[model samples]
Each structure stands twice: as structure tokens, then as C-alpha cells.
Target: MLNRVILIGRLTRDPELRYTPTGVAVTQFTLAVDRPFTNQQNEREADFINIVTWRQLAETCANYLRKGRLTAVEGRIQVRNYENNEGRKVYVTEVVADNVRFLESANREPASGGGMREEAPQSRYGNQRSQQQDPFSDDGKPIDISDDDLPF
Candidate 1:
């Protein structure tokens, strides 16, 4: 009875936003997910998955997300069967997103030399800033932790 899916991947293209006749916002996009293992040729394989979002989330995704942006989506898989014009039956499967998390942080530093800078993280709902601070020191030093103090 469980039909849940969690995916973290890069977008294949910009999200397309539209509205239903009742004025509800809807967005559709494709995500490119890399396979866990590489092929014999040493190239990693990828799967392009179709995703759909509804309401406010859909609007937010369409407005802020772009091609190649990394994102995490939580949703359920949906499968449907249809008959084509050639009288052939086809099966379609896609993810219907319930909630989406923008994985890339918005506080990225500018790129050196003339390359594209890394994107900062953005919230889908509003511009509320994050309060969580990094555990590491500003000078790239790690926080001291002793094995004897481990909770696990």
C-alpha cells in the first residue's frame, strides 16, 4: 500500500508553468538522474524522469527553477494506459510531486576567472533566510570531535 518516491537530480529543462481552467497553477519538467554504477565504457548512465507539480508549488518551481538546477522532489509514481492513434496501447509513468526542495543553496560565492558562479539556494515559498550555521570554521577547519563522545 505504500507508493512513495524520493528523488534528487538535475533538471533537464526549464519548468513549464500553466494554469487549469479553474485557475490552479501546474508545472511540468523532466529530471536527469544518474545511475549508481558506471557502464563498461566508464560512462555513467542517466534516466530522464517526468514530474508534475500542482498549485503554489508549481508556480514557485516554474518561476525560480531553470535547466540544470539540482532539485529534490518528493512524490508518488503515477501510471496510466492509453490507446494511440495507430490502435496501439501505451503505458505512461510519471511522478506527481507533492513537495519539492531546492537543493542548491543561494549563498554561493562568485566564480573566479570568468566562469559561471555557483547558484545559491532559494526557498519555494518565500525569501525567508535560513538560521542554521555551518559547523565548520570560516578558515576551512573542522570542528573537533572525540570518538569517546560519540552518541552512537
Candidate 2:
């Protein structure tokens, strides 16, 4: 069965990191995702989705994610039930995120006033990596590629 889900939204609150009895790291956060269409009142409504990440990803999320930060989550849907203290069965549905990406840079605000050139992307893994020059990013000057360059 297929159970993959991908979502892009802002965090409703700061991530909560905790450790289990086995010393495993876990983080839980909520993502506020706005529905595609507006309601009759022309107001956009948002859904708060619970997300859980484990191990290194959990720690990474806890360290980097903050409230109202835009992020992309890739994971699967998990639904589980437990008995409450009041003898009621409570069902919980959460996304067990395996991969989470920060859409914007931690140092830069999304809507800074002054117009500035866009910077290369950064990942949670490493520092600014040197991006290979894109052939299309030049001054509209085309590189001469001879027929000999084609192996076929």
C-alpha cells in the first residue's frame, strides 16, 4: 500500500524535542497549512498538522525549526489509538516525517525591504556549498559545442 505524503507549510509553534527511555531523540511540531480555496466568507482557513521526526532528523528539526518558519515535510500518515485516563478511546493522526526541509534561510527574512540578489540554497546538512555554474546563467553568450563533442 502507498502511504507517502508531502506538505509545505509554516510551523504553528516551536518544535518540541524529547528523548525516549532508550535515549532516542524525537521531535514533534505542528504545521499550519492553508486550504487551497477560500470559504464563502473569502477567508482562507488553515489546518494544523502534527508532525513527528526521529533520531538525527528529530534533533536537526528541533535545532533549526521555529514558529512560523516555512518548511517542507515528506513522510507517511500514521493513525493510532490509545485509551485515555477517562476510559475513552482517543485516536491520533500524525505525519511521521522522515525528511524535513527549510524553504527559506535562517539568516534571511522572506520579505526583506531592500532588493537583493538571490543566494544559493543551503541545506541542514552543511554550509554554503559552491554551486556549479549554470550554463544558462551567463550573459546570453552561448558556448560553442562542436559536433566532435557529441559521442554519438
Candidate 3:
């Protein structure tokens, strides 16, 4: 009776935003998540997952998210089938994201795009506090955490 999925990964490309006939916003993108274990060739593998977002969230993601940006997606897995033009049934599996969190700073150069970067939207999924340093930064600097910061 429950269907939920949570994934943390980098975006494979910029989100494509579109509007439906009813004027509702929709976005589609792919996320590349790494596997926990290496393959027999000792190489790490990844799974490319398709993500879809709707309405305001879709607009926000398309405007702020870019290729190679680390992000967190929370949603449900969906599988639907439809007949193709060739008279074959095509089954598609994708995640319908309800929430998305940006995991990187906006100051860094994007993986592909080159243009003026606007400030991200202010929301739970967007930047919350601008002045506070992110403890999970991937800058290779040692984090300074006190005992009180630990849960256990």
C-alpha cells in the first residue's frame, strides 16, 4: 500500500521543462546514482533514473538545476504501459518526484552551461539560509563538528 523512493545523485543533464495543454508545468530529467559495490572489473557502476516533477517544483528545478549537479529526489516509482506507433506495447518506469533538494552551492561553475546564474529560489528544496556553511560540502576540507552535533 506504500510506494516511495529516495535517491541522491548527480543530474545527467539539464531538466527539460514543458507545459501541458492545461498550462501546468512539467519537468523531466535523468539522475545518475552510483551502486554500492564495484563490478568484477573493479569499476563502480551507476544507474540512470528518469525523474519527473510537476507544477511549481518543476519550474524551480528547470531554472536552478543543471548537469552534474548533486541533488536529492524523493518520490514514488511509477510504471505505465502504452502502445507505440509500431503497434508494440512500451512499458516505462520513472520516478514522479515530489521533492527535490539541491546538494551543491550556486557559486561553482556548471558542468556544461555557461551563462549568468541567477540566485536559486527560496524554498525547502531551494536554498534556505544563504550565510550558513554547508557541512556536507565536497570541497575536501575537514569538517568541524562538535559532540553536540552528533545524534549519538
| Higher-scoring candidate on lDDT, 1 or 2 | 2
The C-alpha stretches of model 3 lying farther than 4 A from their native spots are 108-152
Which 10-residue span in candidate 3 carries the lowest summed lDDT? 110-119
Best by TM-score: 2
Higher-lDDT candidate among 1 and 3? Answer: 3
Q: What is the lDDT of residue 24 in candidate 1?
A: 97
Worst 10-residue lDDT window for candidate 1 reads 109-118
lDDT tens digits, residue span 1-38, model 1: 99999888889999999999999999999999899999
For model 1, the stretches where C-alpha displacement exceeds 4 angstroms are: 105-122, 128-152
lDDT of 2: 0.82
The worst-scoring run of ten residues by lDDT in candidate 2 lies at 111-120
lDDT of 3 at 101: 74
Candidate 3 clash pair list: none
Q: How far out, in Å, is residue 47 in model 3?
A: 0.4
Higher-scoring candidate on TM-score, 1 or 2: 2
* Ranked candidates (TM-score, high to low): 2, 3, 1
Superior by lDDT: candidate 2 or candidate 3: 3
